[model samples]
Target: MKAMTYRGPYKLRVDSKPDPVIEHPNDAIVRVELAAICGSDLHLYHGMMPDTRIGHTFGHEFVGTVVEIGGSVQSLAVGDRVLVPFNIYCGSCFFCARGLYSNCHNVNPNATAIGGIYGYSHSTGGYDGGQAEFVRVPFADVGPTVIPDDITDEDALLLTDAFSTGYFGAQIADIEEGDTAVVFGAGPVGLAAARSCWLMGAGRVIVVDHLDYRLRKAEDFAYAETVNFGQVGDIVRDLKFLTDGLGADVAIDAVGAEADGHVLQHVTSAKLKLQGGSPVALNWAIDSVRKGGTVSVMGAYGPMFSAVKFGDAMNKGLTLRMNQAPVKRQWSRLFDHIRAGYVKPSDLITHRFPLDEIAEAYHVFSAKLDDIIKPVIVPAS
Candidate 1:
């Protein structure tokens, strides 16, 4: 098998690797069909996450066919098409029982964090990811959702992460049917958040980002009313104006360190040479929300901490909800939307490459080359 491996800071290589097998009775082996590059993958490529072994695969968003399943995996079988959840959760864990699978104790084993994520660091449970020809899916029954024939893999793949994260962001923001929602960042996740907000029946969805291309795409996709931060000097003021002088009912921060509110911490390991987030965008989300509004932070973050204006948040009686998407928890509902054609996330994908060309895919998508938004890697059988 050929897998994308993390080489060094700003480096990646396609290398031959041993094929994976089911290691647990509840596990399954998946032949990856369409694996897409995610913004989170940038963390590993740039060496921002630690504890990722030198040769670990580097992707989490993918759809695949089940090649084999363990005896205990009765819910899934060979030849089943499935969307893999980024979060690995043990079904019997205390958190899983409470529908908080991302915080499953047995799988995550981190006091500070609740979920074990694919292709992340040891702190994230060190699971080998799906950016290769094959991947071993542990706790398969609790993770993957079978995709119906009516939905294409490209449309269903995002149920694994991006769309789910966006839905999670909306959930945390407490976005109600007539509420106005604002999303900071028009990247894939940001756009997804906007789309999800609309799907949730938001009265108005406003997407803010500095990139015109992304904002244009967001508008085309009906994700929201696009706001170009670069063109408008006062982004916060513009958001307020869009919301009729009252801040948005809910504001989601999807721009991590790239925005303003992050404390840049330099951490060194085999992977994740450095990682951080944006305090400015986070503060803007906080400031752009109504007095009784909710703010959801779902973009990727690192060990770096940001100074938060707790006094302001408290004075306004704002609610703050933040976390990586509980991918496992949201998979079912997302698949429902995909199956119903209510959400076609495939429109976000603009580039494709072979497994060996994974590095190039990263370069193109990371640089947003040629207006590329999402790039999917199709490993040859």
Candidate 2:
């Protein structure tokens, strides 16, 4: 099998590796059909995530056919085409029983916070990801949802992470009807969150970013107002002005560890590893929302201490809600939305790369070249 191997910071290659076999009775071996490079993957790619070992594959958003399965995997079969959730969890755990699969206590024994995440650094779970010809899926019965007959492969891929996360971001924001919602960052997750705000009855939606291309996509795809943080003098103040001086009712920070608003913050957090992640976008979220409003964090951040505006959030009585989205939890609503033609997740695909050229694919996405929003990886391309 050929897998994308991470050598070190910004170094990757397609290496021939041994094929994964079923290691548990409930495990399944999926032959990767389509995979995606997620923005959070950039955290691991840039050496921000701790314990991302060399030779480990880095991909979490993927859909594939089950080529083989263990005997106890009753929910799936060898021939099933499946949409695997990024979360790897035991179905019987306390967290899983409460529908908090992303926080399953039975997985990732070393971590007390997030549960097992496919292809993320060992901090989440050391399990390899699906950025290859095949991947091993643990607790297969609880994780992989068989792709519905009406769904496309690309759409299913998005649900594995990005789209589901976006909807979750909106869900946790608790947007009231006629409320104004602001989403920071214009990446795939942020774009989806902006679009979802309309479905959640937000009166207005605004997306903030520094890139013209992404901001343009936010307008076209999300039907939301766009603001380039670079053009605005003070983003928080500008957001207040847009919302008639009070502030947005809800603010979502979709830009995480690698946020670029503050040069010093970016350098210390992303480059020097002094802080967990840059809190520029998050701080802005805290400062931009109306008093007693909500601030939802959908971005991926390191476990280290960030300079978040906790004092301000407390002073303003803001409701802070966030989590690593349990991808399967959002599927029912997402499937209905996709089938009804509300939003086509595939529209976010700006580029595609073959597994052989995955290194180049990572480079193009990491560099933000070619107006890339999301890039699909074809294992058989």
| Best candidate, TM-score | 2
lDDT of 1 at 202: 93
Candidate 2: where is the Cα deviation over 4 Å?
259-276
TM per candidate comes to 0.92, 0.96
User: Candidate 2 local accuracy as lDDT?
Assistant: 0.89
**TM-score of candidate 1 versus the correct structure, residues matched by position:** 0.92
Q: Each candidate's lDDT (Cα)?
A: 0.79, 0.89
Give a tens-digit lDDT track for model 1, residues 1-381. Answer: 888888776678889999998798999999999998888787777666767677778788888999999989988989999988888888787777887777778886654566788777666888888899999999888888888777788888877888778888887777788999989878788888888887777998888876778889889875578877767767878888887898999999887764111223211101222226436667888899989889899877665465767788999999999977777676667768877777888888888899988888888866667987878899988
How many Å off is the CA of 15 in candidate 2?
0.4
lDDT by residue for model 2 over 1-381, one digit each (tens)?
999999998899999999999899999999999999999888788777778999999899999999999999889988899999999999798899999999999889669988999999788889999999999999998999999999999999999999899989999999999999999989999999999999899999999988889999999999999998778788889999998899999999888777322232321223343455657788999999999999999988765366778999999999999999998999988999999999898888899999998989988988789899999999973
